[model samples]
Target: IDPGHGAQDAGAIGNGLLEKNINLEVALKLQSRLHQAGALTVMSRTSDTFDSLQTRVSKGAQASADIFISIHANANDNSGANGTETYYDTTYAAAHSVKLAQQVQPRMVSALGTKDRGVKTAGFYVIKYSRMPSILLETGFVTNPIDASILKSTAAKDRLASGIATGVSNYFDVK
Candidate 1:
């Protein structure tokens, strides 16, 4: 499942690209790729809209999904910062969340050739509220030039989807 955004909370923006749109696009692509890989998938949002954090968490819980991956793009004051990073809730003891991130980070970095912004822990709303193993992936710094270019490309987006699908398959041991 994917969390749209913080709701009424427009995430970061760069080069006239809104973070919300990037998140939705990546989430949709990830859903499609995962389905093609024979994994059942669901998304918290499929359009340009806002969803409350509680609603997203509730949806995941209701689905009783094995894993939840929240797709998002990063932004920073330092436009030079660029990389793909994943996050798991620090309070959660689920190793799968971290392991999933570990499995995907390399693929993202390799496919996009972006900086390797190592996995980190955060008390993100989505991760914190999710009952199942959950991860929030920051695909890249939308504020950065190089990263922005990649985000705008269909090829790069598809590559990101493939990497995410590969990671999920690895996590579930789905051949």
Candidate 2:
């Protein structure tokens, strides 16, 4: 599991919520859930620390992770751009990455009741170079009032974490 940004890199900031903080919180929750389901997890950073993109990819490669999921909150100059989306890169593990993204995308929308921005292809540094199936989840747009409200709620975060965990289990056909 990789939380998007941290420490000096606060990621996107909006509505008084730091994307880094939310990313870490959701990542930790998802990690706990995955652990309960008997999945061995590796986190890029377990605390409020920063790691370069290459470092994150190296950690996953070193651990021989089956799948790499990076958690992040989105932001937009236009606050009206609000929704949940998942991204996958075609450079490596393309098909599996798409499948993993498809699994997580709707679960996020269902969990958060946000607009479904759908799964997309992107060349993000982490997902692009990782040899394993990889996905980056834009949980919601923090700049939007509705989405921000949902993201700021503790109960919603738990549901979002559960939704993501379920998606991973579905991808592996595991309980």
How many pairs of residues collide in each model? 0, 0
How well is each residue in 1-175 modelled by candidate 1, as lDDT tens digits? 6845744666888977778888888788888888898888878888767778888888888888888888889999999988999899856646778887788788888878889998898999989878788888898888999899999888998888888888888877832
Given candidate 1, what's the lDDT at residue 86? Answer: 86
lDDT of 2 by residue, 75-121 (tens): 99999999999999999989899999988899989999999999999
Q: lDDT (0-100) at residue 4 of candidate 1?
A: 55
**lDDT score for residue 12 of model 2:** 96
Cα TM-score per model? 0.93, 0.98
For model 1, what is the error of residue 105's alpha carbon versus the real structure, in angstroms, after optimal superposition? 1.2
Cα RMSD, model 1: 1.8
